[model samples]
Target: MIFTRKRQPLNKLTIAHAAYTLQKEVKWLGITLNPTLSPNLHLRMVKTKTNNTIKQLTQIIQPTFGLCQREARILIVGVMMTKILHGSIIWYTNKNRNTVRKKLTGRLFQAVQLSTGMMKQPPLPCLELYGGIRDITKQNIRLAHNYLHTKLAALIDDGHRTLIWKDLTVPQPIHPSPLNNLIEKNTLLQQHFTRTETLSPFPVPPWCHRGSWKENKSGLALRNLELTWRAPKG
Candidate 1:
């Protein structure tokens, strides 16, 4: 299959003497990735799965001849929700993604109410009040931050540095930094470094200018500091 993105060259190219057909989206590693690299398709898939799970749990957690409120709550939260939010950290980024996540969260909230013999169609705030669940969006943000922190820590501890870190030593005048994508996605990492002028497990490179901690009091100021991994060749 040919993977042609929007507004790109639509040249019909094929290999091994076979023609290829263009597809709008493709399933990769159990995630549906689209031409725009958005997670909308994956969100819909998750929504369906969550709905089915909720329905099945609801039947088993009925008030009579079923699990009690506490038992149902534990099972639904620990098992169903966990299954639904497996890879949320990677895809749950923008407002649209949050909206999709809210749909699942709302369903979970309703399921909690149903299991507890409460009103099924209660308001959002009422659900939080009774269900005692944190804001789903905030939870996703915290999960994303934790995932990023783990990745950074592992990169720092690796015996052999990645190619991107290795590129920091090379004086490439024409190319941009390979770490730009990482810095863009994980803003928390940038904020952490900005507050503390320390990149542990890696020494301050010659390219990175070490400014006094007092020089930038406001953590909001995003200064373009030249960070490097190699020492200056004096």
Candidate 2:
């Protein structure tokens, strides 16, 4: 952990969720109404839904932290939060270091709740899976027989999605955010995450990391998603 995001500690006075917004971006190509098609944004609405799971993250983030209307947002079109999940390798910071450590602690390990599933999307002709995301668009593989789909399959089979630990009684692989911890991930909690914005190296199941080209078929990507804690249905 080399980077540490800077922030002033929580004094109860600075714990303001109203000052923030959960804006994360999704990069994709879009197909419009008729002949015209281009890249578009699939924004997720954070507005409290009837489903208990959807509100889980927003409830904590909305009142406890001081985030803005993003509670109604699912995705922010062009923004992303990869650094918070996958972590940084080259230039690190305090914001990132603390975030990294808080995320792996054993105590909160049991508290994390995740859902694994998938949504319908299209296919990409070829995906340029960037490695060691920093500043370089480095190339990894040039598939001959199969392209992105095959690569996504390998990621899923290898366990990119299938790790859920709602009970925390068992050891589970960590990924998805909006995770609850006895201890806070950000020591100096702020309205928004100030640490390095890093992406997981295939952290979310291939499906979670899916795009126009390939998708994770196991429905394990649910681990990266969050839903409100509802009492089990009768």
Top model by TM-score, which number?
A: 1
lDDT of 1 by residue, 3-108 (tens): 2235225444343333434356543223344667545665665657655766666565454332343443345444334333433432444445545444444444
Q: Which stretches of candidate 2 lie over 4 Å from their true place?
A: 1-56, 60-90, 94-96, 103-112, 116-234
Error of 2 at 114 (Å): 3.5
**True lDDT of residue 35, candidate 1:** 65
Clashes of each: 1, 43
Best by lDDT: 1
**How many collisions between residues are there in candidate 1?**
1
* Candidate 2, 1-234: lDDT as tens digits: 112222224322211122221122221111011112221211111111112332343344333321221221221111112212222221222345554333322112111211111101211222335344433211111121133334434433432232211222334443233312111222334214432211222212212332222222221111122312111122
